[model samples]
Target: MQETILNIYLVIDKGSVTSFRAKAYEMEGEDSAKIGFLKERATEDFASAFVFDSPKNKKGEYMPYKKFSKLEKQGLQYQLFEEIFEKFRVPQNPLICVTPVVDGEVFGKK
Candidate 1:
C-alpha cells in the first residue's frame, strides 16, 4: 500500500485501553484516521520507564514486566501501557508518536 506516516495517541480511561491513529499530516487534523493498537511492538524504547535495553545483551533488557514484549517502544505500545496505568491512578498526558507501521505498526517520527 502507500507509505503513510501515522500519528497515534494512546489513551486509557476507566480501565479500558484504546488507541487512536491519525494521519501524520492531514488537513482534517489528528482525528481524521482510525484508532487502534499495534499487537506487533517496536525495537526501541521511546520514552518509557518499563522498556530499557542494554547494547551488550539485548535479551535480558526489555519491557517492565515479562508480560510485555521487548519491542514495545520503537512501536507505540509503550505509550499505551503508560496511559493505562495512569488511568488507574489519575489519567493524564496521553502519549503520542509518528511512525510508519509495518503492515500497520509504528514509531519512526518525522
Candidate 2:
C-alpha cells in the first residue's frame, strides 16, 4: 500500500479573531525537503499573523473554544475568542472555502 502526500498552506490574519486562507496541494511523493520549503513559503507568503504551529484535523478546529473557555473560567488568558464574536459577524470578511485542483481537475472535471 502507498500513501498519498498532501501539501497544505494557511494564511492567518492578525487584528481581532485571526482569519486565514488555507490551500492544499495533493501531490505524489512525500519529500522531506518540501516540508521545510512549505514552512518557509507559508511564512513569507502570509504577511499578518505568523505561523504558531502546523495544521490539524477539523474536529479539533473548535477545540480552541473549549480551551479558551477553560482559560476564561480559570482566569488565565486575558481575552477569549468569543469576545470578538461580534466583529466576526461582518460581511467583508465572510468565511470562505476554496478547494483547488482536486484529483488533477481544476474545476472538478477530468
Error of model 2, residue 41, in angstroms: 0.8
Per-residue error for 56 in candidate 1, Å, reads: 37
Candidate 2, residues 1-110, lDDT tens digits: the string is: 22222222222222121222333333334455445444544433333322233223475442233443476488653222222223333223222222222222222112
The total number of steric clashes, by the backbone 3 Å criterion, in model 2 comes to 0
> Candidate 2, residue 66: CA error in Å?
9.7
What's the lDDT for residue 71 in model 2? 67
Across 1-110, the per-residue lDDT of candidate 1 in tens digits comes to 22222334322223222233332322222422322222122223223313212121265432232222334535544454443344333224332343333322344432
Give candidate 2's TM-score.
0.27
State in Å the error of residue 42, model 1.
Answer: 20
Name the 10 consecutive residues with the lowest summed lDDT in model 1: 34-43
Clashing pairs in 2: none
Task: Give me the overall lDDT of model 2.
Answer: 0.31
